[model samples]
Target chain A: MNEKMSSRTLRTLPREKAFYFFTSIGNYTGESATSLKEFTDKISEVNVKSLEFHLYRGDFEKWTAETLEDQKLAREIENLRNQNYSGTALKEQLYNILSKYYEKIISKF
Target chain B: MKFKDNTVALDATDLRILNALQENARQTYTAIGKSLGIAHSTVYDRIKRMERHGIIKEYTAVIDAQKAGAKNIIAIMTIFTDPKESDKVAEKLCEAPQILEVYTSLSEELLIIAKVVAENQESLHEFIASSVAPLPGVLRIRTSMITKKFKETRFSIANNPKQLAFIKEKSNK
Candidate 1:
């Protein structure tokens, strides 16, 4: 057991290349390990156990920069960008955004 | 992001509580109330209801496995056994002290992810070779040690438009 524990200690956390590739800002064309280190440092203060970077669900094709740049939507996105935006903020922002989309549908009815 | 059918419904206040607790589980009710701008009594009541309904499962600190100095060996052990042998194998695996979490995957593979914090690697390896493999129905064990924790949390991004869109765009080939 002692021998095994020591060996395990030498090992570090595994990096899922695919996971980082998708979540990275802009087109991240660089060494994965290095890029990951940089990304990790940027959000190092944020304490989260395991971040499930959703690699699927809301497609960007649904809305363009112009749509997001609308005064209301822009403020919403800015609020979301706050460094202190935690899980609660994220959810609220999402609810508000979805509600706006819903409003667009309701008005057509 | 759309949740599954059984998604739990939570009001704004409830979500705020969950968010606070997720960041710091040991936070007191009074502290949580102060942060969320709710009364202490309400916080207490909501927590009680959440626990009863199974939303707040348990409070635990996120310990650094490396700092814990244990044999953190995460492995997917495939246990091939008949119906009669299933119970026997599962029983044995569960009994292992080093095994932290275990789950049976849909692929019929017994995914035994373990975080063994031992004094040294030799002891960990010995335990795996001598103790883990000898068990009945244990066919193969593939081990992978976590090299670096880029991001880890029990929280979910079921909502977050930016993150949701980010994921959606990536997945679409």
Candidate 2:
């Protein structure tokens, strides 16, 4: 329950004050992202903000299922899709979920 | 009839021709004429008129800089110069081969966007320090490196619907 709320919070938070998270992602990562899979893979190396932005824009379900090949993560991401959240709010929600996922993966080692 | 800016008015047929040429400059007048349902001679005459009016500049090829081994670091520099010496500073900046575009902004700062090709970052730093930093009236220089380019386009006639309609209406008459 707490994890769900935190994921929602990650989706909503803004990354930087200089520009919108989407614009910042393009500037930093290069705008060669033609597909959701490419966008997700490229941004994984840079800041998580870009990934958060894509997730907020409702790309996570496809990216997780197709690119990441994580059906569990896809199902988790699907719950947050189309909830009428603003761009910043959606990013914050995504950030929370991604952070937890990383922590869980790291703890196993 | 004259355009709003008092420029030579282009009719609908002229606009259609311009739009087609913009898409592919190498396209033949016969092809353009066929597409627009106009005579080839009419297409040729309209293009000539547009050229005379300075509406159509030189047709150019867009090259991929990365593939050509001309990939370089691009920087947008806002140069603060003495208010009276702004013009002189801009002139000097334009003379530098590394500088691509120069413009004077509404403010006192002189904006210079340049590309520098070098073996490494150190050489680029040295080039800027020796060539750009020492210019007269160069009070301050702030540069932001362009990491990525999303879209760069030449003249886009297709995007201007209002102008297209105005030109089309004139052609109808």
Candidate 3:
């Protein structure tokens, strides 16, 4: 019973995931692409994966740890991957569980 | 005119509980009771009664727009449509993914608000140019970004205090 209560406590707790990126690169910036490519390549070199990016329209896009030509773009992708690597998968699994719980909660009303 | 059979009256405690609940639905009954200096059981009873009356319909989490990676934008569109096409236009608006909330207000006010999470300003411009303005019912669209959420509350437990039951009775009719 103690174990059940502990698990219930864990389940009831709220958590938030936040992400940030430096996508403010400017045009006519000399060697910007090369610099960005180098940075993103370094992030990808670390072997991270499983990141997902959400678009403005509630659409989900996957971010693999693979290197891109532009370092800046690559870092943005890697940032998403690093944050999501396992936590995002866990979040999805959790939502599936909680959706069932919400179904029950609503039915009671 | 006969009053609608489904309409019911809410008391003072009921109104207070509702006003508080709208701000934060997850607030504990004990805390709510402490705020009102009532017993926890009284708060629970009032909430239960409110539920039965369909006054308290649902509890929702109000996620911060920036935290969710989406920025809120308010848009007003005046559609020159015949009454017959209103249904189709409303249906189309409902299905649009960018639209977070939509409402039909007084005849002068018809609003459709959308929240888009883009990487930069260019993407936001792209979304407006490509997706929103092209909808069927859209005659003219004006968009504005929300700098801050000043105040938002959905359901209130208390009856509007200053307006006595006379106003409530007339509005309910």
lDDT of 1 by residue, A1-104 (tens): 24343233222333331112212211112112212223334233222211112112121211212222223433444444443444544445444554554345
- Candidate 3 structure quality by residue, lDDT tens digits, A1-109: 2444323322321111101111121111011111222323332322112112222111122211121112333344334434533444534432343344334433443
Please provide, for model 2 over A1-109, each residue's C-alpha lDDT reduced to its tens digit, 9 standing for 90 to 100. 2555334322322111111123221122222233323333344443555555555655557645654455666777777665644455655665566666655644444
Model 3 clash pairs?
A36-A70, A36-A71, A36-A72, A37-A70, A37-A71, A56-B117, B15-B157, B15-B158, B18-B157, B19-B157
Scored on chain A only, each candidate's TM-score is 0.30, 0.49, 0.22
Backbone clashes in model 3: 10
Give the residue spans of candidate 2 off by over 4 A.
Answer: A1-109, B1-6, B108-120, B159-161, B164-173
Q: Per-residue lDDT tens digits of candidate 1, residues B17-119?
A: 7767776778899999887667999999988988877888888767776687754544333434445556675667678776665555535543434444344
The 0-to-1 C-alpha lDDT of every candidate, in the order given, reads 0.47, 0.60, 0.44
Question: For each candidate, what TM-score against the reference?
Answer: 0.44, 0.53, 0.43
Angstrom error of the Cα, residue B42, model 2: value is 0.5
Report the lDDT tens digits of candidate 3 across residue range B1-173.
Answer: 11399766765566667766876789999999897677999999988877877777888777676688765454333333334445665666677675555555336545433344444555554554345444444444444444556886553433455534433453355
Can you give the lDDT of residue A77 in candidate 2? Answer: 75
